[model samples]
Target chain A: MVLLACGTAMAQLPIYNVGRAPTEAELHPSDGVVGSDGKELPPGRGTAKEGETIYAAKCAACHGKNGEGIYPWPRLVGGIGTLNTPIPVQTVGSYSPYATTIWDYIQRAMPPFPLEKNLTPDNIYALTALLLYWNGIIKEIDVMDKNSLPEVQMPNRHGFYPDPPQSTPNKDGTWQPYWNQAKPAAK
Target chain B: MNSKMSDRRGFLKGTAAMAGLAVGAIPFANGNALASVTPGEPNTSMGVTKLGVTPDEPNIQDLLYGGRSRYETTVRIPSVGWNGATGLRNLTPLQDSIGVITPSSYHYLVQHDMHITNIDPRQHTLMIYGMVDRPLVFTMEELKRLPSVSRIHFLECTGNSGLMHYKSMLHDQKLGRADLTVIQAMHGRVSTSEWTGVPLSLLLKGAGVQKQASWLVAEGADLCRHAKSFPLAKAMDDVIVAYGQNGEALRREQGYPLRLVVPGWQGVNNVKYVKRIKLVDKPYYLGRETSSYTNLKPNGKASWYESQVGPKSLITYPSDAHHLPERGLYEISGLAWSGRGAISRVEVSTDGGRTWKDAQLQQPVFRKAFTRFRLGWNWSGAETVIMSRCTNEYGDIQPTMLELAKLWGDQVTPHYTGEEIEHWWETAAIMEFLNNPILPWRVKPDGSVQDALYNTLYNTNGPSKNSYYSGGKI
Candidate 1:
């Protein structure tokens, strides 16, 4: 087949600029992505107690009775201090570095099957709280919201160390590492 | 190979061989009726006639009358997969594959979920919004109108060769012969195709991307709405909002209508059935982005290792589980590819990794696409090991199994859970997620190439005492 590098040599312009301007209303619902700072989280509130009931009905079938994880389906609890072990069981309590990721995932793609079954903001919040509480990251009565969700510290929050930025080739074409790479100071 | 019989020139050659076989050689599984048609015989009832017959009997036409045909012999070898899902992917037949271009039909598929999306081109609309001056929505027809490009590139899954980490356990009785060809089963996940699509840069330019945008969160149209964030730098570089594969509309499994082709990156980042492109100042930290694809480091930390399909080459003809007919005068053929750039060279070694010789690369080696390489060798019937190594344009060389094991640090054990299970790998099973190690095929004295556990084993001890990372008497 004729292989033309798509955007290279941008000479002759505007062949098929046929898209319409999207309205704000059309963009909002699909646009919500709760950030690490909780900037875009939608109005929602749920307690771990409220989430336990929803977990049994909507999630337990695939995630296990108590978040132990069904086979093929991922395990969601336990393994809190196992990351450094030879056989690290990377469950939610032990591995997920961010709490916002948990909430965003349940809302966007959870229950696995039937694809995007829209979970209400409250349902998502409750499920997120239930998961955290079951993993011992949060208390049973702790209520989760847009403000509190991002504030919850995950066990592995400080476990990660950012990679040193990769260095480009030098002017003389010799390979070189990034100079004076910044390392976090020891406590 | 049903397609083989249909070709007039090839069929003539086949007829000579056919006379020696049993009557009515069935072509496909379940003994289909197509096999009943005898060679050199004209069957007007099925609208098929001999190659040189008159037009009166609806004979097969010449090359100008082009159309597609079904083939049974060219089939993927299947294996048990996640959840026994309906969306199970079959491995590509790399042994039979020739040249750089993988037929769209043979392109390996890896579905995250069970949904094989059937999106209507007319109904599908790609939305580009967030951190943009103009939020835009385009139909499939509209996107086709933009300045387009067709490129030859390879797409590979992050877990493409993950099974190689347990090569020793794979041959054990518990795992059995079923997992023997872990290379074929997993390596097939990487395939090259000529993809056609509009440049993602043009779409971003059309949206008037905001200066603050540092990431582009691409979303797919499937049920999971599978989403991932790509560095804005790469998005504006060589990315393509692709809709066609191998010169035609994409096959259903390859994301028909539209998808993102992030040249040279991990396949998961190339988001299939792509529907939205949202620009943001920071990464969205999507569930998949945060958890699944990260490389678990030996220090117990994780690194977001995406982009750049590692340098790898496999000797397909002399690969795992395949027996050689005879020892003398064999042309060793294989495929080598790199996400960094074009494959600069490929080296073959007949005596394990002790020595190496350069292989001839077939022409038309495009950047980020599979480069076919071949070398001729005459074996005198002595048992030996054969391996291949590749170096990309970026000067990155394929690492050995020993080196990769050290790099990833021996945490390679399999995490099997059932209480009734047996023979799980030892805890110190040092894993290499991107296993591009030099695979050594042991050719036995009988002219049959035997699949050996050399990668997992160090000394002459066999499979049971393999796992060199587990202190197995190396």
Candidate 2:
């Protein structure tokens, strides 16, 4: 239901139209959120074999020689089944539920701050493919693009559960937790 | 007439003598009284320099832009190492904090990529689109022209005390040392501010939001384009597209031109430098929500999208690293807050939770904003532990460390019995996002106050493993 400005009183609220309608040129095609459906993925293609060289030159300094990770920086490979262990190593292979997230994270934020915008769409695709191959999810020759990246299923896809519903504060200055409320449908 | 004249002369002589004593206490460095003096010099008897002693004054150029007195030296320090890649997480000095409102300069900061984007307000615009009849683009001036409201609230990082928990737990198991202070070390990732902006509900209403919209994704204008998804219910409730903070344009470190003020929510969802808001039917499940911020449970399952901080309180004045000089009468003060609502009550304990007394809560406590509390105590200059716990209007009381460990199924110590595990199973279903636990401080006989948990783990439980203190220092 749309939350109306007027409550049950049905009073006419003043509409001070301050902002103007955005033009077609002002609206970008992508909102920058690449969901699990991969609807927002841009056009790009790369193979793991081509990504190895790019990974060695650009990513290996911080992610380590084979993605074992330098101290403090994140590891991008292995630890596929370590989520259930006492020391759950939450690498990309072990924790991420969607493959599109790998591309989304690389495109938005990677290789630290000063050089974040240096990577192109093709460079990001190659890095994502390299990390996936290092994690043994894809073969070295497998190609990754906007289409196939979302099709690749991650091992921990079914691991996460929705959080409990938030409590609503009442007029009496007390709150009631929505513990009995049903969880939202999974995306 | 002669007696009156003599009395006036005597009073003038007494005033001259008092002036001489004041001059003797702080010797001037040179003929110019405004010059700063170096201590321990030959002429300086008390080793102190007094300002405003003479009629000849310094220029007002220093007053053009106000600054704190040179005597005040408290500052925010980076929580992590000097490396820039880790995204310098500067922490506020909670020990020195005076009240609920944190100064914008002293506010805690966490830049994901350690890049502070310099945004020009005149050129910056906020775009609201997706599932709306009219997709609106609002310039900063246009937003300011709309009806605006100012609300005081807090923004806290989800990983605020995660490190403290790990270190304290490690110390519990006799693995590592845990020497920490209240500043930057224990509780510093949270800060309160009075944000001025138009209510997001008004913006969404102006756009005529569609019925199918269940969530809205807010994105920042940083180099990384940080983003997070919020439920539409929350967006329409109390969210504010804030432009002003603490009665002025935001500081550059605090997203300068624009940001989202999601009241009472986790700090990550309060996207800074916010530029875009897109309404959607389902959650975007962005990289932050997926790869990070998800709470990994001990049962091999991780809970996602958990927001809202629980009730928590911290004693600031007599906290860790503070020294009481021949303790007599002292007023213990601290801050308490909750995401659910305003703090209804706060109780302080001087004997390590054995006895408690109701603390006086400062009036006009707003919902979800920091509330200051104070209590009076007389210390006999002996060893004892002091702590505080608070309850919110929602009746949610802050838990103890052992209670929290039981809730998370965390083996705090090796002595967990079967009965304890059975009891934990009964209460495991409780929502456990906010890691609020009672933090105690131990007052030593030598008048030094230390973190009680750290002292118990390192000094009492076993021999000290390592003496290395791992936290940012001012």
Candidate 3:
């Protein structure tokens, strides 16, 4: 009987069309994501030196003086070649696959509290440069903008592989793990 | 590989048997001592000599405003610590809980902001914006008027058991350790609740989602403004814009007036105090997704794993913290759940993972909800290790620590440098972050059931280290 009800429910094409349409202005800043290819980066630029000062004032306390990080907090530098070790300390340069993610994260949630010290676009760019420089990925004086940040190559760039697909329970049907199936041979 | 109980005991004695060992640590008598005990009856009674004076206390139950007996104390949320001032985490007492549904007040708390956002229900509004035909805003009352749905689901942190593997590898031999039981340390981070809300799909459909939109950023109104991006696919599937929890308005700590209930996903994705959802074409690479919850691979790459609670199970009764005074007919019970689908089977093993028996699952085992399971065990009073493993209907069997290490250890390593991967394979922390492995409680010859890690306090820093949070204010 329940299956019959579900079958009937599935027969329907659409349900309640509830909310109203949104305008482009309402979605402006928070809507888009900056891709790894630097597609959606907002206009901004900053140098590692400026970011060094910002780091001392805002980030160093929780992230550690050299981005080595304190416990339960998180390290921003070092931990290179340590992933497979017993004490793998995942840091920015050593573990992150993309450099843009650093800028993206800092812009959204650095300090992570009070929600007061909202960083500007330039500050986010500068911190990204400083973090990359500290990790030996870039020179200290290098200025970062949308283009340069995207161009900055990370060591772990080629490291990430797709997750192993596993099945998920869904109402319509069982969702298969996308990564788990055998790939077809190329023609 | 080194599977003998005697071998582990000798190792624990050598390493952790300090001078001031606790007395009565071992139980007396074996399986033979319980031979005379009846299956359903016990002959022991307290010798209170007030038999005829009971009527003088309170006759005919005339008292008003009945209260719970003093002896019936509910489980407390064990405080771990504070993340600065605004963030705090408290683990639910999974060891003391019974049945599948965790009481509303007993639910585990994980907050990025310590200051609970208190919103006036009259003024609060939920805004749906971005790539939609019609951007819409709904008040709390307006949302309630929409078709509401209620469902029970489990919400678990991505790093729920992040310390189990690390604790396990502290020593070579695994002894029954009270401090390292999965229930006391890890399982407490997850809880199930019956959430009531309007389906996000209906809201999105009402807004007429644009063809190009692929992501939705759900933002909270908390001080931290913690936000995460969800796949458009998932947001339109089972996501709920929830306002009620356990049949009542949500608690202040649980987003008060509004939150998103993304069933079967990591707890973080279900943003609390949800005020706005902005649709987009790509993932926002938000702070939580990029820096906090993403997995670090051995090759040094990071991958995002936000959704789907994996298949896992743990025995709560006869667990590491609790004591078994006598060895007799004992009914062992625990919870099993999967993010993939309904749990198909649960198998219990009495001799480590060598032998297995099917356990009975309680009714109404809904997908993505907790399923209570039980099995009766007749202990022979011999030294043994008991554990359980769950299999979801999708044929996803819960992996043991060894199997998980072999599979995902490479992904967790910083770089595939020669020896670190091999070392990671040998350690226990590799599998600690996800679904914790089936924990084993060793039934000692003294008839006491204890965690396999009981004696090794020196190696794992004891049970206090079980808390992932520390009590520090920002």
TM-score order, best first, reads: 2, 1, 3
Candidate 3 at A30: error in angstroms?
7.4
| Top candidate when judged by DockQ against the true structure | 2
TM-score list, all predictions = 0.80, 0.81, 0.74
Candidate 3 lDDT, tens digit per residue, B185-211?
A: 556778889999999998888777899
Question: How accurate locally is residue B66 in candidate 2, as Cα lDDT from 0 to 100?
Answer: 70
Cα-based lDDT for every prediction: 0.67, 0.69, 0.64
Clashing pairs in 1: A6-B149, A16-B145, B410-B430, B412-B429, B412-B430
Error of 1 at B5 (Å): 18
Best by lDDT: 2
Error of 1 at B52 (Å): 17
User: Over the stretch B244-297, how does candidate 1's per-residue lDDT look in tens digits?
Assistant: 999899988888889999887788888889888888887676777666676666
